[model samples]
Target: MKNLIILLLFLFVGQQNIYAQKTIKIWVVRHAEKDVSNPKDKDPDLSPLGKERAEALAKYLKGEKIDSIFSTNYKRTRLTGYPTADKTGLTIQTYDPATHSELAKNLIKNAEGKRMLIIGHSNTVQEILVAFGAQKPVKELTEDDYDYIFELTIKGDKREVKVDRYGAEHHTKE
Candidate 1:
């Protein structure tokens, strides 16, 4: 009878520890399409279609409990994350694309058990995945590809990554 009580106590404590280590969900995406009409402006903002796509992205993640939003110091990236940040009532936090490894470490530390959204460029999306210790290498997104959504789930020492599509259907030419 005493052994049975001790076993139950051990089981309860183990379950509590398991519950304490919650899984972290990180959503990654490239910035929306930019307007290249102005040649002089080095940092152009999102185009009309880009704005619409941003709105769709916000709607897609509206139900999610996004704890933080990260974007580069670029206009396009900031605009892409603005809608979601506004919806979640969280301000956009800027991160340097040059220091992706450090950013990944900080994200893992601060965003544990929380949902985070990151807006980056096509060139940097793959690097972010690699920084998070993703098993598979993500291909560089094409210039016209703005619908890719990379979902990363981190639970303890295990990490899983899945690619999804969001916003309007992008018609790629063969």
Candidate 2:
């Protein structure tokens, strides 16, 4: 019984080592532009421009080591994250769009010290950024916007956010 208890303690500590709060980077973006031809379709596929944008994003982050990819259960979001997932050879994990807090916890739990790409919608991106306690993050994204990226570096209790743009810049008419 003493030997068994000692072995169990060793196993538990080994498992805990994998979950140490190591610094990590998380890139958040709204899904690439979606097909608007079928205006009535709730889940339209990615538009040609969107596909190109997704490829661009993958190329832009090619040098980084992506450990995970996440997206909502929607054609557009999945397709938007597909390029990165393919490049990283990582499967895209689907999460409920409304469960922002749970998603944040999942990222920290599964990807400690790793990097990830989270594909989200314009509105949901705001929620995700908020869940990370991002600083100076955008509150909302417009339909015409698809190039912004919210890059976050998390170290223990500190989260630093940086805003960047990928692919062609969206020109919102004044």
lDDT of 2 at 56: 88
Q: Lowest lDDT 10-mer window, candidate 2?
A: 132-141
Query: Against the true structure, what is each candidate's TM-score?
Result: 0.89, 0.83
Please identify model 1 stretches exceeding 4 Å from their true place: 2-20
Candidate 1 per-residue C-alpha lDDT over 1-174 given as tens digits, one digit per residue, 9 for 90 to 100: 999999999999999997887888988899988999998998999999999999988998988899989999999999999999888899999999999889999877777789989898888897888898886445457777788888999987888999888888765624
| lDDT comparing candidate 2 with the true structure | 0.86
| Residue 30 lDDT, candidate 2, scale 0-100 | 91
lDDT (Cα atoms) of all candidates against the true structure: 0.87, 0.86
Check candidate 1 and list the clashing pairs.
none
